[model samples]
Target: MSATISPLAPKKYPKMPVIEGVRIATAEAGIKYRNRTDLLAMVFDPGTAVAGVFTKSKCPSAPVDYCRQNLSAGKARVLVVNSGTAKAFTGKKGRASTALTGEAAAKAAGCSESEVFLASTGVIGEPLDTNKFSHLLAGLVKDGKPDLWTEAAKAIMTTDTYPKVASQTVKLGDADVTINGIAKGAGMIAPDMATMLSFIATDAPIAAPVLQDLLSRGTAKTFNAVTVDSDTSTSDTLLFFATGKAGSRGAPKISDPKDARLGAFRR
Candidate 1:
């Protein structure tokens, strides 16, 4: 979500400019809520770098499983997220459903299944209807775009009172790059990560490894440092996507957390 004049916090969230090389789509696939967008898909530029942090819990959602395995591929072309029914504890079917969603996302975005990152949040133990993905995802091509960040953030929320968003600009080579982030957590926040979901995007050029390091440290400070209740959900997820289309802006190299560049990045 871009920055805004939110009454909940009275802090203005940035009205972020649309990042280049990204497409977004949302639909009420009936995975849970009715007449509301419950599913969101983001198609990144083919060369985008992606990184993620998941709940330390061994028991995770089917979509979480899909992401964990695909992360090994070290690339992501699209992200498919849903709220309402978190397909956790359903064992094999959960895994299968996640795989199905990834496949559908790949096809819709013209990428491989391994390039899709998936996540879900909502009622646990309920078997997710994987068919809904094919039916609803087919229509997202027209709805997905960089400006839908806020909708995407809110769609994945479980118990958040107000949507969380942050944005900043940094120098990437000769060009100025911007990072936009959104988080959801009002309950179930504790432990290794917290029952929260966050996505941060930037228009810069960075290797996936460097991006992962920055994301790990950033989340450790922000989400890991905050809490409301003392429970962490099985669906906790964090992701960072770098759309390299921002051109060859020479961003200062981020070597360690102590590097002064992170001050611009983390802020």
Candidate 2:
């Protein structure tokens, strides 16, 4: 972690609210930084829908490829992310690392490997040693809680001066829903696609297809429009997860992109 927070950092961080059906945990795996967190586990409820946008870079990271392959499943139960190694350009070793990590995460979260998403960012071309943190996943999942958004964001930081987080509450029909997001980036950012690493979660009951449509459109106008150094990283990823917990509160399950009740959320 950077010793100094960015000058452009928010003057006052917002109090992040817990999103129902999502619990997070962080661990100091000693992947790179010492005495600070470097791994994050986000455990989701069963049937949670997922969507994502990744970098346009042809040489993407191992986790990027792994995530793209699993995105077709649309359902997610766990997300395991780490900092300190992009795990790009390491050939078969990178692929093996992701596989090991995925299997461990799936076992820990009690989900299938296809439902476990992964992301990593940091030194490129260096092979990430999954052994460093894969053994810690079970404990992380067991201790996960919903109020760890800030810690979760910090665990994924590389060169980032501070953890990036934001939240919003909106009405989906007459039911209230909340959205929370976390991101990490300091340099080598550009609008090739997502530009940086970000993960968002919502309590809205939206289908994966609708979430994908919303994420794609939102990226074009937001993350894809931003630039820093005109350079993009091999691990640029933005993933969105909808846990559908709001359905119990009267929020409608929206599978159609044109659903009228999503007006507030769409805006």
Candidate 3:
């Protein structure tokens, strides 16, 4: 959303493919900025698997705690993300904001509160007003579509000069599957994990545990390898969602990260 793009940014953004069972919508809630989107809502079909890597900072954001607790469920129905005021170091108010936002997202997605994931970015220690955007969840869910990757990436950006996105298609067993990812980072570059926030979606039929293993391992070589500064942000978060819609196209279900059938997809 900045007037200038990063010199290291990709010359041209890739065309993001739509993954079945995944829908996204973005809104401008005026949480911190005006005339630009700052809220993102992503809905996943039931049974979608999820994995994540977050900041190692001891004082993490409230949304980080909310996600860590719900990750054990191994299922995801919705994701709500915001940029501007990170809900961190605000004690009870931070927790209240996450709970209220999660409840709103769950109601809109028709899923349990335990199935919703949340992430926030920007200035830390500021009390986030969940009401600023929580009320827009129902409308986002109703208007969401599967091809808004560009807008979704832009909505969650803070200091980043440009939206970062990547996509790849590979054969998962006998079926073809696609991976689409978007990331936001610039100033807080030394991610213990990248205020770096990233989200990836795939149509592969992989289980949550396997997705977790793959994501954890992948982060070590990618996000965790970059260092832009000595300080790490408390709001850093990365998440992946697998919708398993590829199963209908003959992709075999994978429950183990070491499965030889995923050889090509692993690379």
Q: What C-alpha lDDT do the candidate models reach, one value each?
A: 0.75, 0.93, 0.91
For model 3, how does the per-residue alpha-carbon lDDT over 39-147 read when each residue is reduced to its tens digit? 9999999999999888999999999999999998889999999999899898999999999999999999999998999999888888998889988999998899999
Higher-TM-score candidate of 1 and 3: 3
Overall local distance difference test of candidate 2: 0.93
* Cα RMSDs, all models: 3.6, 0.9, 1.0
lDDT head-to-head 1 vs 2, winner: 2
* Model number with the top lDDT: 2
In order of appearance, the predictions have TM-scores of 0.88, 0.98, 0.98
Candidate 3 clash pair list: none
Can you give the lDDT of residue 95 in candidate 2?
Answer: 99
lDDT for position 60 in model 3: 90
Ranking under TM-score, best-scoring first?
2, 3, 1
Candidate 2 wrongly placed segments (more than 4 Å)? 193-195
- Where is model 1 poorest over a 10-residue stretch in terms of lDDT? 1-10
Per-residue alpha-carbon lDDT of candidate 2 for residues 145-176, written as tens digits (9 for 90 to 100): 99999998899988888889999999999999
Alpha carbon deviation, residue 186, candidate 1 (Å): 2.4
